[model samples]
Target: MLTEKQIATETHKQKSKFVTVIHPEKLIATKTTEENNDNTFLISWLFLIGSLMFLLDGFIELSEGLSIHVLLHITASGVFTIASALFIPKK
Candidate 1:
């Protein structure tokens, strides 16, 4: 029963009720290029160190035949060593 003009005006009124939305720009901590590179290098080194530890454990297992104690010792020492190195203060 509504005319075309009436429908158009009603739609316009509903759309105009919403205000324009503005989104804030993302805030990210910017690191220096050297620092960024250092982070990536440190990550790669960690991967390398982890793989080395796994390989070392494999070797220890082979030599020890079938001993869980030696395996546990090696794993614990590797973890502790890495943790200490990471926690140490840098000059």
Candidate 2:
């Protein structure tokens, strides 16, 4: 009868057999607390700003006439803008 702790250890050992990890600590080291909120907030806003700029550039190019290129530019910018929103800090 294995204890819960022993079971978890055994499971981890078995999983490690099929996969090799280098610098496993770094995988989990990035998470902490609210201290990272500021960085996330700034980076998310910057990313959104860049996306907006790209969208603006697409608009400027719009004067050239609507075509596949303009549509693609607007689409890519929209995707990145949505992704950047995921990084916004939660309250």
Candidate 3:
């Protein structure tokens, strides 16, 4: 049966224990915009190459006519495609 005032004081004490006192003006990004964009594109290109390899493997399995290997390759290719798509550049 704590009073509202008692509860608020306790809550304030707990919150203050975790409060960080950093100046907002001191925060900065380490990488330039162009550098970040280039890194993203490079990672996406590597993933795209892997996905392409899986796609080719799937096509080869298709020639064997409907098997688990084909299904697995297709599933892997689709997953890799989605992953790679996330890092692709907008421009």
Candidate 4:
């Protein structure tokens, strides 16, 4: 048995009790970017070392006769380089 005015007043009271808000998604994006950068840095280091080892082994094999040790080093370095290139993210 509420009047029109009473219903309106109750609606206004309920609306006043609730507030709307906005949130930014940039914070999450920034954290993700930072994590990617860290991973890229680590992978870059690994790639550089691996590339150097591969080159050194190639040079040794060229200057001297091919040995089992030199062959093993070359194979291992090649595998590391390929792995890093495939898995590393560019950020």
- 68 in model 3: Cα distance from truth in Å? 2.4
Query: What does candidate 3 score in Cα RMSD to the true structure?
Result: 4.9
lDDT by residue for model 1 over 13-90, one digit each (tens)? 998897765555423456687887777667756765775676587666758675787677667767755764564434
lDDT of candidate 2 over 18-69, digit per residue (tens):
7566797897787766768877888889998988899889888888899999
- For every candidate in turn, the CA RMSD to the true structure comes to 9.6, 8.2, 4.9, 10.4
Q: Would you list the C-alpha lDDT of every candidate in the order shown?
A: 0.69, 0.85, 0.83, 0.75
Q: What TM-score do all the candidates reach, one by one?
A: 0.38, 0.59, 0.57, 0.43
Q: For each candidate, how many residue pairs have backbone atoms clashing (under 3 Å)?
A: 0, 0, 0, 0
Best-fitting candidate, scored by lDDT: 2
**Tens digits of lDDT, candidate 4, 1-91:** 9999999999999988976665578555566767778977897878877786786777678578777877777787777777766766655
Off by over 4 Å in 2: 1-32
Candidate 1: regions farther than 4 A off: 1-25, 66-91
Q: Per-residue lDDT for 29 in model 2? A: 82
What TM-score does model 3 achieve against the real structure?
0.57
User: Candidate 2 at 32: error in angstroms?
Assistant: 5.4
True lDDT of residue 27, candidate 1: 31
Error of model 2, residue 68, in angstroms: 1.0
Candidate 3 local lDDT, 4-68, one digit each (tens): 99999999998887757777666663678899888988888898888878888888888989988
